[model samples]
Target: MPRSLAARIVQDPSDGFRHLPHLHTQAPDLHVSFDVLGGGRIRARMAGPAVPALRGTEHKADLGARPDEVHGASARLCARWKERFVDFQPVDDQGRALRDRQRPFATVADLTAAPEHELRAVVADLVRGGASLLFDTLLRGDDVQTAVFRSYLRSALSQQGLRIRFDSDLHLPWPMLCVAADPSAGKASLDTLFARFLGHRHQIEHTGDAYAWIGTPRTTQSQPVVSLNHDVRVGRTTKADAVAKVLADGTLCTVRTTYEELIRDFEQPHLDEQLMYFWCHGEFVGNAPEPPVLAIRLTDGTPFDGHTVRELRADYRHSSFRPLVLLNACYAGLAGASADRSFLSRMLIEHGAQGVLGPLIAMPQAFAAEYALEFITRYLRADANAGRITHDLARHFAAQYRNPLAFTYGLHGGMDAQLERANGGEA
Candidate 1:
């Protein structure tokens, strides 16, 4: 099964060498094209074996929409349940029992103990509500793109891995947009969208060779105090530990912690790691004239703003090294508006990474760690490529966990790309 979608441009620095080893035997199953025109206007088109080509179906993105409006709907929906739960009173008798089961919770830890179904209900509402906004806002009134997107949803629901290639001036986080059918309200329902597809399972890859596999873990916190957000035990170390164990057992890669160390390491010739994984903090610092810079921290807790990121990528772009980066950082993959373009993500794509994956919003540490572990483990053990492995793992994780966090991660690149394994064999 095809397990991922890829987006790239003809001007990609990696150029001819971006094709993966596994793709040598076959032709691409899908192709998506994007045209960025004068005055910030952008247009997109999707065609594949599963799609019926239609005339005049090219869809244009509304770059004119207020930056806030373009990405606001989904962000608000995600927070709706979290904020509403406090004031929500269960009207039915069962709602009381549900509340009791979830009571005595002052902190996130206490919240985590709530019944899975109860939590799922809240998330489902978010998914359904958010899907409508996405369809209307991002799909931008194009019947063809909407129809093709619906087919993609159905394919994902059927457990068939997806391999889509998108070419666009502006990167759209396709996975963040939800689509589901709702018969009762005469609109899409939450149930259908919630069951649409697991997010982490899909890989957004790029068409290129991996420079090398590298993992950087920033396990310790910058501040000494334990706040509610910080107190939530995230698998920061657990994710790093798991990857380290696997790599140490024979994966060809390097793991670094400090910013200085990582910078020095990359300056050397041996730092040509293709798969770059970072377990650190990511921030979206909004400013004028520069869009929003994604601020990622080093081991020493220093910040690397978007400009710095662009510079680093330029260095790599000029060299023979190109990487596929995975950021376990918050907001690194946040679906942003045209006004607040995803600086880090775009920087990476422009620099030469075949693809990049990161959470759209802040994700639970424990859950993120577990999810990474699952994706990495499968990537190593299965014959499927990275995208397929992600799809399968996400499917299992969503089925078992039932949390929407799994869907928050966004893929920006060739989700269909593959790499060699530590065992010196392609998986």
Candidate 2:
């Protein structure tokens, strides 16, 4: 990590920490409640320094009952997004482009040279579509929830370190929900309002857990793990090289070739890695009616998903180390509209992954590669907190490529997660 691009951009002379309030801290915390009322009903509630009144709202949405409708709406939304915003040739989870790759424009050169208006158009379209889906469909008729959330924002006094812990089953894209949007004001995305909205299965009793560990693990010096499944088709080899270059030395102890091997390696003694990175393709398997399972590629080019990962995770359930997993897989960050814990991201969390950074939908290999390089490079060079690193990488890529797909990647863990490598970690 000889002061790479991300390092040079983010590192400072005084301290490695950049001290962006939004990225560095999780302050002015708000408690959000979304309880299951049985029969596809949900009760949304809010409380904090912002919501002293302690109010809540209820809504009806049964993913199991209306699976087709929910799935169809999601598909339509994603399709429209792709049609409007995708500029570069995007490969599916198998690294195959839906259309011919040799077209008017496909490479990174074409992407960088694309006009600013084109980028702005993509952002504008994304904001509009995302806002419509969130408000008109997801939060429909839930005026109290919106009003309470707005009040929470007002009470924060524009502080950027707002952390709203969502304890609900409605896997809503809380990060994308717009607080305020004015095209003339250049405020298109809601990411600027808060660092992140923490989510989980149950309530968070203490604020300290949101940033730092509430209880110490038995092992503190355990090295992190990097599992880069081999995939020459989509240029994953280069991506893996980038990660290995950064996490060199003994900072990364277990660099496995396959998912099974990675799990086996972790089973060995003195191999409790605190952090793990997965670089491969991921997709949703299974048809409608039954929720889709997240399928990810292995070193042998075989794909495995949430069910397989969950089985392996059980092997480490009693282990003290709760690793932070970085998933470069497409749809690795997506959560369906249900309480079901089958999605890859949620499954990892349930299986003791401290948190996960992944994409909410399918991602372009080029974009995913660049984002990974930037994130790992910054993390190694600046030692910035993981949440901050995610936001920074997405923001930097969005600005550089004028691609709103950067917003697809998000931090799904404690807002205060900081991943520090062993003494000699280099990117």
Q: Which candidate is the best by lDDT?
A: 2
TM-score against truth, every candidate: 0.69, 0.70
Per-residue lDDT for 162-246 in model 1, tens only?
4655554444455544445353322433334455533532334322223322222111212111101111123544555665465
TM-score of 2: 0.70
Clashing pairs in 2: 246-426, 246-427
What alpha-carbon RMSD in Å does predicted model 2 have with respect to the real structure? 11.4
Off by over 4 Å in 2: 1-28, 50-76, 87-112, 142-161, 183-218, 222-233, 236-240, 266-270, 287-289, 337-342, 420-427
**Stretches of model 1 off by over 4 angstroms after superposition:** 1-42, 55-68, 77-117, 140-160, 183-193, 197-240, 286-289, 313-318, 339-341, 421-424
lDDT of 2 by residue, 1-427 (tens): 4764643456547443443324434542566554555665645455566445533532223222233344345455555555655544446689887574532122341255554444554555555555555445544454555554544534442344445565554454545444333444234333331222221111121111222322234344445454444443555434556665665544655556676775576454344555667777776677778866777786576666666666665565545656667788876766444434236666666655667777766666666777777776665454666666665554555455544565566566644555544464422
Tell me the whole-model lDDT of each prediction, alpha carbons only. Answer: 0.51, 0.53
